[model samples]
Target chain A: MRIVVLAGGIGGARFLRGLKSAVPDADITVIGNTGDDIHLFGLKVCPDLDTVMYTLGGGINEDQGWGRTDESFTVKEELAAYGVGPTWFGLGDRDFATHIVRTQMLGAGYPLSAVTEALCDRWQPGVRLLPMSDDRVETHIAITEAGTGERRVIHFQEYWVRLRASVDAEAVVPVGAEQAKPAPGVLEAIAAADVIVFPPSNPVVSVGTILAVPGIREAIAAADAPVVGLSPIVGGAPVRGMADKVLAAVGVESTAAAVALHYGTELLDGWLVDTSDADAVAVVEAAGITCRAVPLMMTDPEATAEMARAALDLAEASR
Target chain B: MRIVVLAGGIGGARFLRGLKSAVPDADITVIGNTGDDIHLFGLKVCPDLDTVMYTLGGGINEDQGWGRTDESFTVKEELAAYGVGPTWFGLGDRDFATHIVRTQMLGAGYPLSAVTEALCDRWQPGVRLLPMSDDRVETHIAITEAGTGERRVIHFQEYWVRLRASVDAEAVVPVGAEQAKPAPGVLEAIAAADVIVFPPSNPVVSVGTILAVPGIREAIAAADAPVVGLSPIVGGAPVRGMADKVLAAVGVESTAAAVALHYGTELLDGWLVDTSDADAVAVVEAAGITCRAVPLMMTDPEATAEMARAALDLAEASR
Candidate 1:
């Protein structure tokens, strides 16, 4: 089977690992989210793309589910000592090489897509990883200050990594998405895909940002393959990360039925909620979408694989 | 006293330490060699400038006399793992920060001289450190390969660090130095100096490259200050490094008197040779240059400081 997955960072990477495990022979093409991509210390950092690459390539910090294993923060510390930093990002030495390589290649006139391919040449992530768009697109978050009540915008990383999403997000904007076209082979991948899956990633920033690119959403909707997704939200809470924070910025409730309705029947053919949120299945089916309730917690690889398998089964059923 | 010193890598850095100890209150301005600067992995690597900065800032790897003190090669190792390298360079994790900061600043349109000043803000090396020029100038060594006998011009770092100057150097070229103008403050520093000293650094690549910058040599020669130099060559060989290899390329014998003659009386008012090369005193003095024999070994800080004091004393005598 030829599969296409729209993914985010840690959660999306882990889901793809499970999907790869569940369908070993399937040719997977990952449309990685670049909304969270940041430039720190003048080096380009693609958090989502790297997460998927390292996870599948077996270089990931398995405990944390992102970045390289045995990573050191020597570079980060030294940069801090030099008083040059955002210092809040957990950019380890091993992770830094990727950024350096990527930045170097980008500076040399290679587009981000080509640079991603060059980097993947080392990792051999087993999936054709294409960034959603090579054009510069950054997610920014507007947050209100506690004491001053001052509204200010900052990079998504500052909101997520630095602020830990503690403050309420007033707005989440993908700064350049309207101007970006889907990367080369993205529309073709969707057109050629036998199965299109949306792993339990942040709908607002991950898969949502990918769809925000001019033709990507239209291509997927027009694709002959069934579009299936698993709920990142279970029992009115996120499986991991602060998905609720961003979802709220888009005025979406932190519930499986609400999220499914947010993607809507036009984009999603099949939607799977966790067994605990079985009530969401009927609510989602009421919206003219095929829905199922399964155990969605990625507690282990086997459990996550079972979840992936269920999504694939739902795709077949929806078709 | 206002003192100006032309410098190279490790030897220059060590000598500067002694110079600082010898005249703690002296207004010292160091004209650091930029010929040794190269782009490695697309990052600006100013090996000589970094050595001096780290040494004076108390961050140098004391044992190796270059790179960061408590350095790790995690970034280097990771870069190697990605197979993106000229893996021969000994860029440590902490040391990489300096380059990253420099490269970033340079990319953002800061001149190298300004970048150096900004970097010095953290190091506080206690001297005004300026590059010979704001423009790029890389020292390349022409050598014949062992088997193919194919002659090629490789970067100075490749010849010195990677090849260890194993093969004979056929030619030494300071690429881009011809068109380079002296960086701001370089000529002014020379003209304003009470005494000018050339520390025991590589004659060809270090001090030679600096002088190659347009108008700098002329500025030093026209300056009113007594210009004195300590020979990096001790007896008939270099005190350290493969200065002899490059010296031969320039058709200058690796002898204290020969190096002095190469600079000539036009440039030098006084010259200091190692006591072992005491016989060279007559040869250098006969060339219309004041010459002295001194213990030139930088075996320890005290010994090195004594050498610096002797050079200063010679400057006074020549005046």
Candidate 2:
């Protein structure tokens, strides 16, 4: 099977782990969200891409679902000692290698796509991981400080990591997305995909940011492949992350049916929500997107694999 | 008293430590060699300046005579794991922070001299540390590669660290030295100094690289101060490093008299050699340079301080 999946960080990585387990032989193309990429200490850090790479390549910290397993914080600690930091973003010693290599390659004139390929060579992630764009497209959140009451826009990392998404997001903007061309092979992967999946990633910032790329959303809409999406929301709250806060920023309700409607029948043919959200299946189907309710809690690889299998089944049903 | 010393890496750092102890209350200005600075992994690694700072700041590894006292190689190991390396140079995790800070400051448009001063504000090396130039002027060694017989120029770090100076250095070239202007305070320090000293650093690459700056050499020659130098050679061999190898590159022998003669009477007023090189005193004196044989081996801080005192005494005698 040739499958293309749009992925964010942790939740998406966990779903990818399950997808790989479900179809070990599938030729997977992961269009990793690059909006979370930030330059820390002058090193380019791609959190989402690294998460997917580490998760699939068996190097991810299973407890955290992000960064490398057995990682040390010597580099970060030393950087802090030198008073150089965005100290809130924990970049471990092992994880830093990825950014160093990526940044070095980027500085040497290799585009982010080629650098991603080079990094994946070491991880052997088994899936082709392409960043949404070679061009810079940072996701920034418009927020007001709870105590200071100062309202301003901050980079997505500062909003997510430093602020911990404590305040409501007024707007989530992908700064350079309108000018960004899909990284090499992204549009091709969408067109060649037998089935396209949006794993359990934040709709407003993760998969939403990927779609923000100028050519990507249009390419997937025109492709012959059936587009399937899994709800990051379980019941009424996010399975992981502050997806609801960002969902509200874009005027979408944090519900399975609303998420399906947010993607819309024009693009999405299938939607998968948790079994607890079964009643919303009819609501989504009423809007023309084929909906299925499955056990969406990724408690383990097997349970997550079952979720992936259900999403593929929905894709077939839509066809 | 205002004193200026030109320095290299380990040898110069060790000498500066002694100089600080010898003249505890004297205002000292060090014109550190930047020729050995190299960009490794896209980070500017200033080995010489760092050596002086760390050695004097109580953070240097006493046994290794370089890098932090309690250092970790996690960053370097991780970089190597990514196959991104010139792995021979041992840059510890703590050492990496200095480079990261420096590279960031340079990227942000701060000149290298300003960056060095800011770094020293933290190290408090007890003496003013100024890079010889704000501009890039890497010391390149021309040599024939072993086995391959490739005659080419390689960075001084590659020559010293990777090649181990096992191959003969045909020529030592400070690539951009000719056009480079001395850093803001370097010429002024030389002009205003009561005395000037050349520590027992490599003449061809370390102190020699500093003198390669056009107006700097002219400035020191015309300075009112008596210019004295301590020979890096003892019993016709380098006290440390492959000073002999690079000295051979410039057709100078690794003897106290030869080194003093190479500096010439036109600029050098006094020369200090090790007690074991007492025989060279007559030869150096014959060349119209005042010569003294002192215990130049910096066995400890006290011994090094004594050597510094002797160098000052020679400066006094020359005056």
Residue runs of model 2 more than 4 Å from their true location after superposition = none
How do all models score by TM-score?
0.98, 0.99
> Candidate 1's residue-wise lDDT over B292-312, tens digit each?
999999999999999999999
Cα error, candidate 2, residue A20 (Å): 1.1
Candidate 2's residue-wise lDDT over B1-319, tens digit each?
9999999999999988888899899999999999999999888999999999999989899999989988888889878877888889999888888888898899889999999998988889999999999999999999997899989999999999998999999999999999899999999999999999999999989999999998888999999999999999999999999999999999999999999999998789999999999999999999999999999999999999999999999999998
DockQ of each: 0.84, 0.73
| Top-DockQ structure, candidate number | 1
Tens-place lDDT per residue, model 1, A29-94, is: 999999999988788999999999999999999998888898888888888987988888899999
Per-model TM-score (chain A alone): 0.99, 0.99
